[model samples]
Target: METAVASAASTGRAQTSRSRCRMSPKRYEAKLRLAEAFVRLVEAMPAERITVNMIAEASGKHRKTFYYHFADKEQLVVWLFRYDLASGLADKFPEDLLVREQDSPDNPLAEFPFYARRIEESGRIYNAPFFAALSYSLEKRRAYYRRIFSTRGPGTLDFYLHQLFFPAIKEDILFLIDREIGRQSAVERKALRERMTSNAGVDFLAEFYTGAFLSRFVERLNYTSARRTARDIIPFENVVHDSLAALIRQEIEKAAREPGSEDRPGKGGAPCASPA
Candidate 1:
């Protein structure tokens, strides 16, 4: 009788273990479906418009299941940004022009091809929900700058702010170029080059080039309520890029000229003690 009782207990334990193992895959699959559904919903509508019911329906899961996997839609959105968007952009350094070799001379112009390629690739991936998720993440973080630097001291604040801002500006410029100019062939490239140089000054030329690229990119997105026109987006993107680049360059030059002028001190004429 004791043997039979032990056998039954073992059987029950084995069954419970198997059941837990089976549930793990199902749970994982459900979470993946929910994330995918969230992406689709955000693409169709803005982040604010997405509801729990909508996500549940889209994922083909019960409302309770969403709660089991995620606390709320906000948590899910945060997860998507932290995991999905970050994963996509992390290793994809635009190699063609953006990041030059350490030995290479400083050449901002070298980055143009990288920007063009990025825009082209962005257009190709425009249909993917990942791009929309990334865009949403960027939009959400726009206020992060103000929040992070608002209380910083002036000396540290200006330097920190530039470090924070320039990368975003550069990325935006690359997005514009990749979307618009990368796809153009030899002839089309020449025509676009001619058009850019026609009446625009040197400063305006960069803006025009970046603007044209971005406008084409936005047009390709076919966003339902896109605020800027194709013609306008490139120039606006360029202006932002140019302004940020100029500001950063100016700051770096000022630091080079007056290493210890500020509260900080360093050799190699670095503004701060450590190298950037």
Candidate 2:
């Protein structure tokens, strides 16, 4: 759900089990300790200033131990996202990082491509415990946002988050597509990777999704009526589910239809058209 963290982590690879999706209970706890310590440090110091030693000291673990759990601080932060979001779910969530779910409490992150896949594959994961877990996890993230981005903008917070989640959703869609098509051949996979990395067929679709969900998240976050909580997101559960499934399906179809380059990376920071 952390935008910066997600972009950094999206090397276009799925997280291996040893990281968190599948880890010994003890290992999960150890990593969680580091994650919590990092969050705690953020409460006092900027994330940029915090170092491995500081995080290790806070977790009461040695420095080398951090490397065992994570390849680098960025990777650790990636798990921090999963750890914080999933812990509240109490093992009811999937093995990877909980995404888009962060914004609307019911939203998706690559969170959705995989999330939509799961909901269709299994009915058990759609139970109340799942939402309950989200309630706790998202609130935790909200508090973190409040403190960390105090000066950023309550007004534009939704927009900023929308921007972040869109990429995750977009990349996740690509990741899913890669699973289906990229593995067919090494060359095809490279082309797929290069293709998806650019903002082609799926950019606007991701934008629509992130906007819809994140706006709802912002509204609930600042509702100012009967303090917002996880339950607030329950009514929208089915809407979110159907929306994600549809969005992903549409995107993949579009990509399949147009297998040529649509846009490149260096747009020279072209500005969006100004409002009239």
Candidate 3:
């Protein structure tokens, strides 16, 4: 009986450990070191020219360890971009102001001050020379973004940007669409038909707008002079935000008026808009 009890306890412990998704502290630290090494390596050479072996060597970890943490180099790039951009913004900027309801009378694009302030603070976090001149890593960041955006295949800049920003705006977009759908009368619903699919396809509008904003923002960063202060470019951020908001609002309104657009549902249905 004692042996059986001990066996059962061991099995239970193994199962619990397998069920946990979190990484061990040591593993997390290893991954972080690998990521930092990747940034440094990319600065010296283009990301395409670098390999898994180079990263592992620079990080002082086994080459197999890179695969243990990430599926491929592209996945590492995704992690690097998020760490470089969103992680820095998380502390200083208010989460509530990041995204707004599509139907909200308040202009969604009016939060440039928040974005600008976050950029101003980002240099201190990443130790990148944002104000004086772009650091080596910052230069690499621009080059990588441009390369990914210009590529014809998968893993485009827009796809990655959508992934980066999707979480913050998801709830707000859902709420806006659900509220709008609920407001329609049964007759209106029939007039709208299945096109009212998934909050009237607001997500397509949001994702497209986010992608355009990210692509343009990256392109601007690539060409922007290093001497330009974050404050000096505040107006440009405002203009980009406003332009994205206006386009999104216009597309949403256009979808609402079109019957053909109504049949296509977003989020696991046939897309009403192009992913590109």
Per-structure clash totals for the candidates: 9, 4, 2
lDDT of each: 0.38, 0.49, 0.45
User: How many angstroms is residue 145 displaced in model 2 relative to the true structure, after the best TM-score fit?
Assistant: 4.2
lDDT of 2 by residue, 74-96 (tens): 55654555555444543565544
Regions more than 4 Å wrong, model 1: 1-28, 39-54, 90-245, 252-276
lDDT of 3 by residue, 1-276 (tens): 122122222321111011112223354587679887987786677667889999999999999999997767766765555444433333343553222112213322121111211222212112112212212223446655555455433454345445434433333334343444444554444433344344535566556655664554555655755633344555453443344334434444555555644454442332234322
Best by lDDT: 2
C-alpha TM-scores of all predictions: 0.31, 0.48, 0.50
Candidates sorted on lDDT, descending: 2, 3, 1
lDDT by residue (tens digit), candidate 1, 39-80: 777656655567999999999999999999676764564344
lDDT of 2 at 220: 55
Backbone clash tally (model 3)? 2
Report the Cα lDDT for candidate 3.
Answer: 0.45
lDDT score, candidate 3, position 196:
33
